[model samples]
Target: MRNSDPTLPPGAPPAAGAYTVPRTDPATPDGVGAVPGPSAAPDRVHAVASPPLVTHRECPAPHVLPGCAQSDGLSPASRYGELFVDVQHSGLFADSKTFPDCIPNCDPELIVTRYREQRATPGFSLADFVQAHFTRASVPESHYVSDPASTLHAHIESLWPVLTRKPMAHPPRSSLLPLPHRYVVPGGRFGELYYWDSYFTMLGLAGSGCGDLLLEMVQNFAYLLDTYGLVPNGTRNYYLSRSQPPVFILMVDLLEREQVARAIDFLPQLRREYAFWMDGAQGLRPGHAHRRAICLADGVVLNRYWDDRCCPREEAFLEDMQTAMYSGRPHHAVFRDLRAAAESGWDFSSRWLDTPAAAQPANLGTIRTTAMLPVDLNALLWHLETRLAELCDQAGDADAGDYRAAAQRRKEAIMQTMWDDAAGAFVDYDWCRGEPRRCLTAATVMPLFLGLAQPAQAQAVAQAIAARLLDQGGLATTELTSGQQWDHPNGWAPMQWLAVRGLARYGHDTLAREIAQRWLATVASLYTHECKLVEKYRIEPCGEHAKGGGGGEYPLQDGFGWTNAVASALMALYGDVAATCRVDVGDADSGGQPGHPLS
Candidate 1:
C-alpha cells in the first residue's frame, strides 16, 4: 500500500488557515511512506510544492473548478482538496491579506476549520462572495453575475427564514379535478409563450425559492424586450403586434430587491421597457382643456391592451365597426378613438364591440367615444413612476427628484379624477366622455393599495369591496353581468392577493382575513385534489365548468406561478401577525360622516 498522492486521492490540504479537504481513498495505506528508507528517501526530504493558485479571473468558472472534472484524472478526495486549496490561495477568502504566509499543505480537517472561521467573520456576507466570483458573461448590459457557489449561499441565507417557519399545507380535496378546454386551445399559440402569464409567474418564482427559474424568466423577458422593443402577449407571430399590460417595471422591482447593484446596472433597459407602455401617450395632445395631459378628448387617460400593427381579420372587422359606429369614420381617426372601446376595465365589453347603430343609445356618447382611464392602470403607473425615480436616484441620475415629484402629482391626479363621490367606490373615468363608468371591478380597489386614496375613500372602497366584490373564497374581478372571464366570476390568485393586501393596508384586518382564509382554503382544496396550485378559481361554487362556460381567449390556465406565490405570502402572513403588521395600514381614520368614504 502506498501513501495517497496529494494530487490524486487524499490530497494534502492548504497550509494552515484554509478550508479542509476530505479524503476520497480511505483504503490507501496511511503510513506507507511515513518512514524514510536509505534509498527511497533522502535524509532531508523535501515536500512537493502544492498546485499553483488560480486567480478568480483566471479560473473562468469557479463554481465548476477544474479539479472537480473527472477528465482531469484526479480522485474525488484529491479534487476537492485541490479545489479548497485553490479557493484559499486564490485570494477568494474573506481576508486573504491577513493570511499572507499561510502554508499550502495541511490536513483536510484543518482546512475545514479555517473555512468555518472565515464564514463566521463579520461583514463577509455570502452576497459579497458571489460578487467576487461570478462573472456575468451572458448579459453584458444586464450585468447578471453567475457564481453558482455564491448564488447558492445567498439563496440559502435569504430563504432559510421562510423555509424554517414552514407555512400551513393546502387542505385536502378529491384527486380528480376539472379543467377547461381553452387552456389547450389549438392554433391559439400566441407570441413568446404567454408573455403576460410568464411575467406574473416570474414574480412567484422570485418570491418562492426558485431563484434559478426566476432568473431564467427575467432573462427571457429581457430577451423579448431586446428583440422586439416590448414583450408581446405570447411568443407566436400572431401575437407580435400587441403587448400585454406593462409588467416590466414590476419585474424590475422584484429583481432589484434580490440584486440591487445588477438591477441598477440595467436601469437604461428598464427605462426603455417603460417607454414601451407609454409609447402611445408620448406625444399625444390633450382631449380636455385644464386636464394636465389628455389621453382622450372627452377626458379619459387610461390605456388599453393592444397591438398597433398586423390586425387580424376578426380584429379588423371589429375596429372598422367601432370606427363607423362611434366617430362615423375609420378607427384610425385618432389614438383616443381606437382605444376608447378597450379603455373600460371591463375587458371585451359588448357595448364597446357593438356597432354604433346597434349599441344602446345611453352607452353611445362621450363614454363610448372617449377613452376611459382605469383606476388600477393609473395607480400602477404612479407606482412605476415612483419606482423608476428611486432607481434613477440610485444610479445618481439628476432627473430622479423631478420624476418622483411628477409621480406624486400623478397620484394626486388619479385620486381626484377617478374617485366617485356618489358611487361609494373608485370608478373608471371616461376622460373624453367627462363622467365615471360607475361599474364595480377589482380595479376599483387599486387606489387603496397605491395609497393614493384618502383614508375615507379607502375605507369606503374597502367596504364596497367587502359588500359586493368579496365572495366566499376571494374577491371577484368584476360583477357577474360583465360576462368577461378576465373580469367577473373568476377570482384570480394575483387579484385575490392584491385585495387581501389592499384591505389589510386600510386596517380592514377582518376582511383581509376573510378573503385570505377563503382563498387559502380554496387553494388547499385545489392543491389536495390536483396536487398543484392553479392560476385562478371560480368563486361562485359552480365548480370549474361554470367558470369555464364563458370564455374568449383560452380556457382557464392552471399551475400558475403568481397563485403559488400569493399562497406562500398569505401563509407567511397568517403564521406571523408581526409580519402582517409590516404591511398594515396605520392610524389613518376614515373620513367622518360617511355611508362609505368614496360616496
Candidate 2:
C-alpha cells in the first residue's frame, strides 16, 4: 500500500526492493494520531525521502615537493610561501629532485631531513641537539639581561621557534580509520561490543567534528536494525540475544542536525528500531501498571546486558565451554572477563553460582539473575520514547498521541518507583528482594540527565555525590571503600562527563566547575604523560600495601571507548562551562544541606 498523503514523511527504503510507506487511514481506528500539546512541535520530523548512501574514497599518496630555489633577494615569509607553492605543485609531477640542486645548501629541507633521519638511525644521538638548543649564555653584570624569572621566560620564548620548526607529522587524515567494531571494550576479552554505548560515543565524536565517523556509526546501527530486528549488544554472533539501552532516537537527532534529509532517509529504519523496543509491550501486556504501552513486571523495564550463547553460569561453565568456543587469539584475559562481567552487572557477586535459589533453568539454559533494573537504562528509554513520539507526530502518524501519552505515563512510573525518598537520590530496585539497592553508584545521578529529578531532589543528589563519591578528579563509579572496581575508587570518563552535565543542568555551577576542572586536568595530565586517551583511572589513594584483587569473573579492566569519547567531549565542554553554569541554578541551592538523605 502506498501512503496517499504527500505531506507524510517518506519511510526507510523498502527492505529488498523499492521503498514504500504502508498506507493507513488518517481517521480510522488504527490511526489514533495524537494532537500536538502546548509544547512547540518540531518543524518537520522527516527531512528527505531518500539520501544517497555514503561513499568513501581512498586517501591519495603524499607528494614530495622539490627543494626551494635559493635566491638572495627572497625574504623569510616569501621563502615559506615559495616552499608551500612547491609542495602544492609537486602533486602535478612525479619526479624527485635532490635537495642541494633544487635549493641552497642551507635549505630548510636539509635541516628537517637530517634531523629526522638522524633521529631514526640507531644511536644517532639527540644529546648534542638538546644541549645546544637549551643552554643559555652567562650574561655580564652590566648587561641587565639576566633577571632569573625573566631569563627563564625568555628561554621558553626562544624554545618555541625551535620546537615549532620540527613539525610533527599527523597520520594521513584518511589513515585514521574508524574502529571496524563500533563499540570496543579495550579490556573486555569479548571481541564484539555493544550498540547503545556506541551511540553515546558517536555523539562525542560528532561534537568533536568527526561527523563522518558519526555518520558511519549511525549507518552501522541502521544496518543492524534493517538486517536484524534490533541491534544486539554487539556485532558478534554470540551477542544476538540481548541489547543494551535504547538511544537510536538520540542518534537520529544528531544526524538530523547534521542534515535533515539524511535523517528522513533513515526514517523507516528508525520506526522499526522503535518497534523492536516496543515489541513485547505492544498490547501484549495491556494490564501492566506502567501503562506506557511497554511493560516489565514490577514497573521495571529495559534488559540488562546478556550473552546467552557464550556467557557461562558457574554450574554450566564446563558444559558451556565444550559447546561454545572462545574467540581465538586472546591478547587480554581481563577484557574477556569484563565482557562476562557486563552480563550480570553484579561484578564479583557470589549469587551467579548455582546455589538452589540463585540459579534458574530457562529456555536459554541455566542462568542466575541479579534481578536489578538499572535506573539509568530506564531513564534513557523514557527519553527515547518521548523522542519517538515527537518523530511520529512530525511524520503525521495517527499513533503519535498514544506514544506521547505512554511516555508521560512511564516517566511518572519511574519517578514514583525509582526515586528513593530516604536515599535522597534515584536507586535501582533489586527485584528479587523488592527493595532499592542503596549503593551510591554513578547511576544515581542519571535521573538528573533525564530531567527526572525534582529541583530539591537534584540538589540533594548532587551534594551527596560531592560529599561521598567525588574525589579530587571526578565522581567515583561507586564509593571507594566498596572493594568492587565498578563500585568505588574508580572513575570512568563517561560517568564524570554525565555528572558534570547533570550538575550543570541543575544549577550547581560551583560544584560542576570543580568536578569538570579536576577531571579535565586529570585527563590532560594522563594524555601528556602517555600521549593517549585511556579507558578508566584509579582515583583512590594507594594504601601502604599495594592490593591486587579480582572482581566478578575477571580482573579490573581499563582503556575503554566510552571513556575516551566522554573525555574528549568533556574537554570541549570545559570552554563554555562558566557561561552556561548559571542557567539552571535556582531555589534548589538551599536544599543541598549536609544531612539530606543521599544514602
lDDT scores in order: 0.45, 0.44
Q: Estimate each model's TM-score.
A: 0.55, 0.55
Model 2, span 264-327: residue lDDT tens: 5666776675565454354443223111122355443442232222222221222222112221
Candidate 2 weakest ten by summed lDDT: 47-56
**Model 1, which residues run further than 4 Å from truth?**
1-192, 259-262, 280-283, 288-306, 313-370, 527-535, 543-550, 575-599
lDDT for each residue of candidate 1 in 410-463, tens digit (9 for 90 to 100)? 666676777887767887766544667766778777766655667777677777
Best by lDDT: 1
For residue 589, model 2's alpha carbon misses the true position, in angstroms, by: 5.1
